[model samples]
Target chain A: MTGPRYTPLVAALPATVPFIGPETQERARGRPFAARLGANENVFGPSPRAIEAMAQAAREVWMYGDPENHDLRHALAAHHGVGADNVVVGEGIDGLLGYLVRMLIAPGDAVATSEGAYPTFNFHVAGFGGVLHKVPYKGDHEDPDALITRAAETGAKLIYLANPDNPMGSWHDAATIARMIKAVPEGALLVLDEAYVDLAPAGTAPAITPEDPRVIRMRTFSKGYGMAGARVGYAIGSAPLIEGFNKIRNHFGMSRIAQAGALAALADQAWLAEVQTRVAEARDRIAAIVRANGLAPLPSATNFVTIDCGGDGAFARRVLAELIARDIFVRMPFVAPHDRCIRVSAGRAEDLAAFEAALPAALDAARRSAG
Target chain B: MTGPRYTPLVAALPATVPFIGPETQERARGRPFAARLGANENVFGPSPRAIEAMAQAAREVWMYGDPENHDLRHALAAHHGVGADNVVVGEGIDGLLGYLVRMLIAPGDAVATSEGAYPTFNFHVAGFGGVLHKVPYKGDHEDPDALITRAAETGAKLIYLANPDNPMGSWHDAATIARMIKAVPEGALLVLDEAYVDLAPAGTAPAITPEDPRVIRMRTFSKGYGMAGARVGYAIGSAPLIEGFNKIRNHFGMSRIAQAGALAALADQAWLAEVQTRVAEARDRIAAIVRANGLAPLPSATNFVTIDCGGDGAFARRVLAELIARDIFVRMPFVAPHDRCIRVSAGRAEDLAAFEAALPAALDAARRSAG
Candidate 1:
């Protein structure tokens, strides 16, 4: 018997995952990584208060989480100096991006993003039948001017830009981003993904008003707040744009324990400051290790540092594979130029020590394999 | 400075929530629900082991949940005697339903469901610009025969049926359901929502192989598993249909803590048995309370009992409002005939006592308002 027919768009889409988890790799290898430095997850862990809140909330899982995400939205709005209507909390930045794409992108719609950028956003756009236009990074950073030019040329409905961006770990300051925001085409909305903004240097985030309908900024608890497993993230935008999410999002998707943990994490700013300090130290350690291994470390505003392997994309891939084979999890960019570098996340002292210990052997192995 | 234009379909859709949560009602009423017997939550709560597992997982929130949900899916597969390829886990039944509808229903695709059935399914169909053909319920129960006939007539892509159904707590035997499954029209997939099947009597669920492509069965942790707030659900179907979820679902949407909790809950079958016993006793208790109030109680195989209010829809609406005014949070059906009943969830002894104490006063108030 013939099964149900999938929509033409869905039928044509490939079944693919944007990123593979470390756990999946571990299961395949039949052993866990000695140092988990991939995926840019904060190794410093969440605030004690957030942990306690989640632990306590575990007993109260009999009731569904408040579908409105009332208290978290209010708290986030107050934190950002905007009205509650300006914020919409969701399953995470990944989940929120899916909703945003669904709300705006229909078949044949044009969207734009930087090449080698967050792949999940591109996945969503493609899933909804939107055509994606990619703009290459200038030097090591996302080129805002090129992205805006492409959007204008293509009449893209949405354009995505990640500040303190992934893979390359390079960032444009707030002043530069402010200029880019104004240059966004008249009808195109800029999706400003600031998932790593919390760990970025001061003045790195632009001073955009909440009522600017031209841009929606995304933030998450995964990196700076150290709660990736909680899957809590939010978007800040104009009321109309934010309210539009209510038309299509999964209203009861949030976990009650996560809501409580995120609320507690937002309250404990002191703990966040501690995490920032720890992350900065870890970045310094990673930089030193890369430098000691005779690699060039790029300037970073995020919790991860990208180290140039002094070779082409294939050489960098070999370096990453050697590191993974040596029981240290690391990743590299997918496109050219940036693919010459290996991305390493800031980890705890013990994890950094393991990475430091493994790097020389991994480098030697990569060199031998290349020869 | 105009915002991005929404697709014509999205622009035409109104923003509406399918279920107004009890928390929303409490906020509107400026107080908390004294007895939360409205949402069909299991007052007996989750297993202690599950709570402990979640509490432990709270400390490991620094890492994202496994994108593949490999461990949970394997456990679920083993429990159901199905291969891992035949099962797909998601955020919740509601979330999965949205994804399923998006996969099958393109703009103007036809779908069939009983009128006034699960509104969330309708909401998803409308959000995706699908045309919904609704058939009226036969008596208080969903008529699967009529639904299949309509599916054939309309060439509907999907048809929805909830066994041990919500709002009315009515169900059909497995033998009858097997007949209905055979009659499902060609090219149409039947969505068999078994949300409350865990609380139904033995042999209530139909014996269908996981390889059956004509029907997809949905099960959840929200009812008899007593973990509503965890937001975990799974669907069983043929391997192709199960794998198609990867094309559109949020890969990392499941909370890490919730996954651990659900895994532990599944392992503890004794806890589920105990919950089933408690739920049955509570149902009997609720039926007794309704009889004592001079109302007719429908025979219930689910956690909640639907009581005939011995009046018309308007009179039942008054009773529901009066119950809410008296701080007894309960709900009723939305359509005619069924609207003559007020649905009450089985609760703990104290919560049931509160409901019992408030019923007399609520009835008196409703009668006075009618007069």
Candidate 2:
């Protein structure tokens, strides 16, 4: 019998996942990492109240989660000072990105993003057969002007930008982002992925303009709120745009535990502050460690630091391999110039200490191998 | 500025969600449900061990769930006696169906299902712009023969069937299902949703054909495992079809607590058996209440009972409205014939008692309205 007939797009797509989990690497290594720092997850953990709320909700797991995600959306609306109609809750930023792309992108739709930006966004665009026009990062930060220009040039439907971006914890100032928002071409909508904005400095994210139909800002509970495993994320946009999600989203996709945890987490801003403090401390420590090891740590506004390895991609890959061998789980960028750096997450003291201890030996091994 | 440009498919789609949540209903009525039996969720709840596991996993919410879902997949494979490569886990059957449709159905591709089958499936088909060919249910059951014929005639890429079906609680025997599987037309795949199979009688499910490319069977923790809010469902099919999910699925969509809860729920088979027993008893209790009210209760192999109101769809709709007026959350089928009945979940004794107390008045109100 013939196998399932995949759509031409799917048949041509590669079988590669966006990110491999640290757990998979641990399993393959036959041992867990001494310092789990890959994938940019908040290693500081979630609020105690969030955990308690999830525990309480676990007993009621028999009922389907509110299909409308009623309470969370309202709370988020109040939090963001937007109408409830201006927000939509999703399983996570990843899931939200997928849904958003599906809503705006048909086959051969033009989409644009930085060449080394979030691969997950690219994955979604390609999944929908959207032709991507890539703009390379300028000086390690996402060049907002370049992206807007590319969007206008390509007549793209969606353009993605992450403030305090992944792989390189560089960010654009609020004024720059606001300027970029204003410059979005008539036909294109900007997908401002603020997944790391929670961990960024106060001036990093642009002021909220919920009715600005030109941009939809994505926020998540995964970073500064320290609840990545909860899979709770939201989008803030104009009412009509937000309502469009109802036409397609898996309305019952959010777990009850996620809703409760995120609700509790949102209520505990003090806990978020605490996480921010911890993350800031961890970032400084990571930067110091990188400097001590003779690598240049890039200025970071998010929960991680990207260390310029002072070498090419091949040299950085060797360093990465050596670090993995030394049980220090870390990642680097995918494209050139940016790939010259290794990205490290802001882990707790002991976790960072493991990375600190392993780095010198890893560097030595990489150097020896290069020679 | 013009609002976000929606794909033509999304723009053409209605804002109607597949199901309006009970929570939304509660909010609209300004009161909580007295007995929430509308959604067919297991009121008996998840296994204690599953709750315990979720509670434990809550502390680790800072980390993303494993993208590969290795441990859970291995366990599911072991449970089903299938190779791990034959299984694909998802947020829920709803989310999986969306991904599956996106993978196999380009715009205007043909898909077939019974008219008034699962609306969420229809929602996904429309979301992907799949042209659907529908056949009428025969005697309140999904007619497999007609569905296959339609698929053959339409050259549909996907055909859907649900055993121990939703809304009407009707089912075909295992032998009939096997015969139907063999009848699936060339270039078409059968989506056999067994969402409620754990509550169905033994010998109701066909024997495993893990390598068979023509049929993909969906199973969930939402029913007998009593974890609907956990949002975990898996598909078992040929290795290639299962792997195709990697192309477009939210790879890290599953929550860590969800993975943990489902794994624990699966291990405690005794709890599943216990839930099955409770569901059977509750079904009988519901049937008795229906008979006492002079309504006709359909035979059910699933967790809910559908009672014919002895009138047309409008009469059943009035009964539904009256029940809602009394704070009893229940549902009715959206299609004719089946729409002549109101479906109620197999709630616990106390929940059923609330329904029993409310049903007489509800019936009286409906009759008065009908008159």
The TM-scores of all predictions, comma-separated, are: 0.99, 0.99
Worst 10 residues of 2 chain A by lDDT: A36-45
Residue-level lDDT of model 1, residues A195-294, one tens digit each, is 9999999999998599998899999999999999999999999999999999999999999999999999999999999999999999899999999989
Model 1 CA lDDT for position B246: 97
lDDT per residue (tens digit) for residues B132-174 in model 2: 9999999989999999999999999999999989888999999
C-alpha lDDT (0 to 100) for residue B182 of candidate 1 = 84
- Cα-based lDDT at residue B127, candidate 1: 92
Q: After superposition, how far is residue A254 of candidate 1 from its true place, in Å?
A: 0.6
List, in the given order, the native-contact fraction of each candidate.
Answer: 0.87, 0.91
DockQ, in order, for the candidates? 0.89, 0.87
Per-residue error (Å), model 1, residue B284: 0.5
